[model samples]
Target: MLAIDETAAARAMIQISRVAKTYRTTDGEIPSLRPIDLSIADGEFVVVVGPSGCGKTTLLRMIAGLMPPSEGEIRVGDRIVTSPHSDVGIVFQSALLLPWRTVLANVMMPVEVKGLPREIYQPRAEALLKMAGLGGFETKHPWQLSGGMQQRVAICRALVHDPKILLMDEPFGALDAMTRERMNAELQRIQRETKKTALLITHSIPEAVFLADRIVVLSERPGAIAAIYTVDLPRPRQLDVLGMPEFVRLTTTIRAHFNAQLD
Candidate 1:
């Protein structure tokens, strides 16, 4: 068993038990993800980084129950994740906002889909907008916003539903360097406030270092746990912290794995 921290005050939000995946292609069986055992403590933020096509998103899909693992089980709380559940919110690379809907309505999409009363959630939607720096843009359409702003709406939509777990699949991968950095800070602030248990997968080592409490790095294709690094940096992390020795050391360690694989 992987050693989980005993200092945690709450139960783990997600648990993976020797999980693995393989796909049957017309050509032959293809291996995707190798055995993975992980524990994400309640309200903790974890990130996964690996080479592209290394089964990073595959790991996330299995955890989210969007796709089933060929072996082993994933448990969210006491329930086995056989299918996607309401308690999980997902964000992908694309903002996926409705162009026709105003920012406010877009944020309310999940609430509406769940058949919850808008009156009860409208205030929350507004508050999320304010927190995302989109307060004044609430009435504007998605086209009026910049890439970062549109993603901010997507983040608000994810949180407006109040899901216990937030799963992100490189939600900022499309942005330029400057925008991505700003989004990272924005995400860190929002996550600190909400304290939702979050697991995100990205290819960027720096991003993984910036937002994660623990970062799990996967090996090449048929991804398996290569290493897991605990980010002991102080909370409410500022952008300037990236220049520190510890931050550089951590990123370097993770990069070494990929660098070695490429050579």
Candidate 2:
């Protein structure tokens, strides 16, 4: 059994300590992520940003328990995450919905997989879809929706399980710039209303600066923490907040950290 570390319980809802990942292939052992230490408080929105292949997705997958770390451990709340848990929800770049299934059906897939009664989870799924602005579209198929609408369904699906932590890997990366910005605002609104802890992995620094309470920057290859910047701007942030002087300053600081890693 994994022992619960009291230090990990300090302010964090999730604690990652000295975690590393390596893949063994015919050629050799390739290190994807170096040992890393990170703590994310309850209800905090943390965005991990870096260049492609910097192991941002690897780190998020490790936290989601989709993959195990080669070393160290990951803890969520009081329990160690050795496998996938109901308390965690994950959304990837693609919506990946079932074409044959209706939006409501896709949202309720997890509840069904968990063997919960349909009657119980059905209402919850409906509510999540409504909250995500797809209330009337629940009967539509993924093929019937726009890119942004499909991603909205994806977000709703992740939350339908009512997970305490949401792990998103470039959820908005496939959308156009305008749609991405709209989804970003929508995400903030949902996070504010639900107060769920979220860890998002993205390559866009501006997106990271716009959405996160704190931005964690990582270096290339055997990824390591390069820097962490706290976004001090006030909450209930508007889309206009992106234009503020403070927002520019913070993004500039984060960009500098990324550039430094490249040097």
TM-score of each: 0.95, 0.95
Candidate 2 Cα errors over 4 Å, as ranges: 1-8
lDDT of 2: 0.90
Model 1: CA > 4 A from native: 1-10
Looking at model 2, the pairs that clash are none
User: Which ten contiguous residues of candidate 1 have the minimum total lDDT?
Assistant: 1-10
- Each candidate: what lDDT? 0.91, 0.90
Which lDDT tens digits does candidate 1 get at residues 1-263? 23445433227789888999998999898899998999898889999998888888988888788999999999898789998887788888999999999999999999998999888899999999999999899899999999999988998998998989989999999999999999999999998898899999888889999999999999998989999999999988899989989999999999999999999
Alpha carbon RMSD to native, model 2: 2.9
